[model samples]
Target: MTPETNAWDGAGKRLYLQEVGTRDGFQMESVFIPTEDKIALIDQLSDAGLAKIEATAFVSPQAIPALRDAEIVLREIRRQPGVVYTCLVPNKRGAERAIEARADELNLVISTSETHNIANLRMTREQSFAALSEVITMARQAKVPVNVSLSCAFGCPMEGDVPADVVLGWAARFLEQGATGITLCDTTGMAYPSQVRALVADFRQRFPQAGLTLHFHNTRGMGLANVLASIAAGADRFDASLGGLGGCPYAPGASGNVCTEEIVHALQLMGYDTGCDLPLLLLAAARLPGLVGHDVPSQLLKAGQRLDLHAPPADFASWRDRALARDQPQTAVS
Candidate 1:
């Protein structure tokens, strides 16, 4: 295929963004964010016109105290008419709760590497997949679309390189078992642009009908770059967290997901239509520090957007005035 075919070029090409701040970002936090704050943030993101939002995850309260109130948060958030609110489901019980909470979509995560899988999920890869098959069945019965996020698809922190076929094979299994979409996650931020391009091209070629999404972390600082490469190579959907809030609690050296504003800012400047309100998204992101009780890792929050401008400093202005006065003619001054 030609290069143009992969790009969101010309007019009318729209890139879909799935905001995962509430679920992914908050999950890894040591301090628990209030349910009200979570609801408010979700409302803010929904108001920003994001196409999709990962609302929360259904897991054991003792396991992830930060997200223990998933049901309450999921139930309380004001649902936008066109926005899809999804939640992560770890197993059959989680899937049942997600179904009861009326989640618009069910996002299930499984690692491709055995070590990482066991570390994160507390189960082997095969065990996690078996559990996911049951979860997928439950989601199908409940009429809730399932989105399986394959973690460690790029490389594992422990096992190192996970082969391309392993990732594809896992995706194929999920699809066969009735998953509606696939999200390839760089759980430890090990993905590169070239690797992302090659994998995306292969995925599209092999699974032409499957809905594809890319999830990246900025741990290695390639999150946004990987996003561009993935999109340029024909993948459109992506997951980004506001203020770059989260990483895998189990994966060593893992970091927060790609920042939503940075992605939007970059893509908007490149002439792709995101349909997400960047200013509104920034407003939501600005609340991260207060809510999470710490400064977030967002580059956009620190650097400001592409058009945010500033005048010269006061000292520079004063110096410039003095220089102008000194350069003037002495006769004129006399």
Candidate 2:
């Protein structure tokens, strides 16, 4: 394993990294990336020490044409030890497909707002809950762990300002139905830092046993701030895509997710151990533009690292020699 940077030397906290690039990143792209490339990307991510990877979604091809090859990808990708490969499932059928693919974990999502829920799933909140209960039961019978994701947990684009009580109530129901984890998703990037902190704290208090993960988009440029707030509120797991790839089709004007490199750099700087190698992650980010056939939105990919200072073209070798000499005080003195 590559040594982690002591960037967070004084912060004294450990953060978990969930690389959602394969699933979330590819979901929104208009171009089709070959399954071979996806597999290669997952392998690279696994080598980077990300504990969890959201590999693919078993949603309807009619709904998400991009993921039509979910089963093929799931079956073909090489699974590395210690990395959890998770797949998103929309309903019972999707859950069955995920199980058939032998997915390590299943993520089932439902929107909190009734209007958004209906619009997205073509079912009422109550109906979706009933469907979710069935899906959870199926996964349990199949011995698959289920992660219940409550989207629009912060504010809904359709209904606006979803009540905390509503989210909490839905979470309670999901847990009662046997969800092993809960992921609060800011689908449209409508969450603020304070709201994120308050919600995470409340949920942590309410569901002590349930593993919580936060998924935020950067549409409003508060994604990292929200992540910091959530971390302060005791959240360790978070979802981020390489180059900030992904946006909800239902959310108008919504942008990509928090960039994986940005999140890792932030956590590392704050003394949180993400177990990711920054240089390797940057390499992966650099490959994204070519694969997606367009420039990505990740800041780190554009600006490079703080340590990546450039030397003038003239006497570049001398500049390097001087820097090396400076590192060796006796040699510099000589």
Question: Which candidate achieves the best lDDT against the true structure?
Answer: 1
Which candidate tops TM-score? 1
lDDT of 2 by residue, 190-216 (tens): 999888888988898888899899999
Give a tens-digit lDDT track for model 1, residues 238-285: 999998888655555545889898888888887888988999999999
Worst 10 residues of 1 by lDDT: 1-10
Q: Provide the TM-score for each candidate, comma-separated.
A: 0.93, 0.89
Q: Which ranges in model 2 have alpha carbons more than 4 Å from their true place?
A: 1-10, 250-254, 313-334
> Candidate 2 deviates by what RMSD?
6.7
Q: Pull out the clashing pairs in model 1.
A: none
